[model samples]
Target: MTIVDVPGSKSITARALFLAAAAEGTTTLVRPLLSDDTEGFAEGLLALGYRVERRPDRWLVQGSPTGPAAREARVYCRDGATTARFLPALAAAGRGDFRFDASAQMRRRPVAPLTRALRGLGVEVRHLEAEGHHPLGITADGIEGGELTLDAGESSQYLTALLMLGPLTRQGLRITVTRLVSAPYVEITLAMMRAFGVEVERRDSPEGEVFDVPPGGYRATTYAIEPDASTASYFFAAAALMGHEVTVAGLGRGALQGDLRFVEVLERMGARVRVTDEATTVAGTGTLDGLTVNMRDVSDTMPTLAALAPFASGPVRIEDVANTRVKECDRLEACAENLRRMGVPVRTGPDWIEIDPAAPGPAEIATHGDHRMVMSFAVASLRTPGVTFDDPGCVRKTFPGFHEAFAALREQWQGLAARR
Candidate 1:
């Protein structure tokens, strides 16, 4: 059996790197995603005057007083949600005019929540073309972080965008989110905020939860990103569906990523999960039992669960994830539609979806040009042969070698089948 340390948490690494880029001095990122998202983010920083060193393993980012930058530049962040959402506010905070644009997918992606939030905080951000979308012309401006409510129903990036900007505001930002989905991502935001230097407090009341982020900038420090739990998820789900033992390395107990809680979801679904300081192990039970789960907090794991659902005995229902409508794609619909195409009994609605395992049939899968879709279906291929993807390279957005890894695993499975 081959052991693989799961890819580094792209979510955590990107968030940490963005925060580190704004700190006072040079910071060393121990393990960051060397993918397109981070590269785009670093390019954005470079355009805004931060010195970035792209190394073999780690990235060294030199931070300075972001008043005047190298030059006024335009940043095309591609389709990376993190770079698209986080860089705009940082560009504005640096008080330099920036023309921020993105790929067609990113153009369609919602940014109005963030622009509205920025406008409320007193930044002069205007859309060049679409009313609430990207292609923003941001004049160097700083806002007094004030109390405001954000409609983060689409994606948690809206909340995270503000969280990163709150501490940098002239006045600390007190934020109250309306229908804040992906609460774990917000928790990840808070954890990263606390790690860097922002002391944000959350209090519970009858009205809702309130966050008080003090007015300050992040502090530069040596930071390490945890292994990507979301990437490890497909492996774990494969083990559960195929009864193979899978161990994901480099994940720590105190990992800043809330997606790490995905191991808990696997456990509840009947996979035996063990967590150590260095790694997480999911021992396959050969077959997973169906689960009726609310994945609002861990929505990134939804596809993995859907892939594993066909192996379960009963119907699996995923709830509280309506926000999946605006992820890299309409993940809920995309996932459900794929499963239905596979002849699995699947039901979907505005916020929830149900998948009941049935006699598997032939289905040509559509990735919808989303990375997560590509990886989740790779897990399904182990159980059902003749399954191919529309765009396999989509995994490069997170893990580039995903299909290759699955191919290696399939070879061994084929060898075993030949002997049988």
Candidate 2:
């Protein structure tokens, strides 16, 4: 079995930074992800006058229970949605005149639901450029958090931001989420909050799910991040597509990430999967079966499945992933377009995509500057030679050395095949 070590979780790293910044005392984060999105989050913290020490293997963040140190600052959020949404909420819990902006791509993405929720909680939030979008301003004395309803249908980051902000509020927060997508991420948030010394009470209400976060902020501690299950999806897909036995270390049945459940999909598609406390393995059985799947919760792995679908014996249909449209790009169309470029038959709707079985040919993948697009098609290229990306380096958003790492794995697999 080929053992692959993926980078630390981006979601965990981002949340860790937020939690550490909001907690009392210093926080040591071991194996934090170092990439454009995560780095941008750390930099935003610095811009807000939070102390962050970056090391080769870990990160040190000084917490301030009251919030950002800077009274006035302009935080450029880069392309990270966490940085864009979470930082504003973090700033709102402090005394500051903070203006936030982002890249053009990020600027197009909506932050309205989050901003509106913040406004309802008695925080002064202004849309500087477009309503409910980034390029916004917050004049905050502090939050007096109370009951509020939210719609997190387009993105879960809105709910995550509010959930993280709960402790910093005056009266604490009673959040009633009217609609939520990607529920597993909320579980990660709650688990991490418990680690940092706060417990959020969750229960079902008539309206929706209710989360009760009490007053008194978090206490800092040492945290170890897990390997990114989303990033590992590419490698897992590679194994299933190429009929290799691949094991990803640091991810087991107990992994906090819901994306790790992508293996179950592979298992259903004829791969032999083994899950244990230490790691998870996927050994392709030289057969791939395709079926319809709803990917609303683990939607991040949708692209990886799309790239692997053409090799399956039947059509692969992915549904309930409409939130993916508002991500770095419209992922459904992007996947459909790229598969078509490979000369595969594909169909798409508002919330689903279907790929008919065919041998994909070489094509230039248009990445739209979205990192997942480049990485997904790179997996497709393992089978279809001469496949190239219009913007290969866009993967710097999550994995800076994805091409190099994937190439190494390809070489290793080839050598194993040769020996066999």
Candidate 3:
């Protein structure tokens, strides 16, 4: 059996940084992802006067329970949306004048929903340049938390930021989510918060969904991050494409990331999947079935599914993924455009895409600076020889060693084919 060791979860790493920084003692993160996004998150914490020791294996963070030591600071989030969204809320927990800026790509992503929610909590938030975009400035005397409502239709990060900040608020926080997308990510946030010794009260009400967070801060402890299931999807997709077995270690049936549900889609496409306590394996049956899948909750894997769709026996229709349009790039359009470039016929609507199976030809896929695009199209390379990428290095956002890993897997697959 061939096993791939993927990096730790970016989501969990970012959340751990936030929770550890806000906790009252020292916390150690075991085997956290060391990628651009996570590095940006750690940098943001450092800017707030939190001490983070980066080691060869683990990260040690000294908690700042009373919030940031520096009253005024500037945090540059680069292209990390999680850092861009979550750090501002963390800044609001402190009494400071803080400015948040991001890379050109992240500046285009929306932050107004989170800003509005912060305003409702009596924190003054201003966009230094654009109205709803990045380059934001916040003047905070700590969150005067109260009842607030926000729409999370554009991105779930807004709700996650608010939920992470809930425990630090003076009056606690009562959040009514008007429109929630990627609901599973909020579950991840709540679950991690609980692990950090904070419990968020959740209930479904007539006025949408309500989360009541009491005013009790987090408790610091040693936390181990799970492998990124989203990154593992690429290896699984490769298995489906080449009729081989690909196992991703450290992500299993009980993984915290909702993207682990992506294996269900692979199973629906006629792939055999075994998820145990330690690892998840995907074995292909030499054929794939096309089906309609709604990937709203686990949208990160939509690109992987799109890459695999062209090789399936029938058409694959992916629906409820409009939120993908607002990600690092217009991912839905990027996927459709790249698939068309690869000679696959793709039809798209505002919230759905249908891909028809066709003979894929070699094409240099434009990655649009989105990491998912770079990684997804790499799976297509296993079947098509001439599959290349315009910006393959964009995968450094989440998986810096992705190309090397993919190459190693290809060599292993070829060796197995020769032995057979």
Stretches of model 1 off by over 4 angstroms after superposition: 65-71, 205-207, 412-420
Please report, as a residue range, the 10-residue window in candidate 2 with the lowest summed lDDT: 151-160
Go through the candidates in order and give the clash count of each.
3, 0, 0
> All candidates' lDDT scores?
0.80, 0.94, 0.91
lDDT of 2 by residue, 161-190 (tens): 999999999899999988999989998999
- In candidate 2 the C-alpha lDDT for residue 143 amounts to 89
Candidate 3 matches the true fold with a TM-score of 0.99
Return the clash pairs for model 2, or none: none
Looking at candidate 1, the ten consecutive residues that score lowest on lDDT are 63-72
Which of the numbered candidates is closest to the native, going by highest lDDT?
2
Q: How much lDDT does candidate 3 score?
A: 0.91
Ranking by lDDT: 2, 3, 1
Q: In model 2, what lDDT does residue 313 have?
A: 98
Q: All candidates' TM-scores?
A: 0.94, 0.99, 0.99
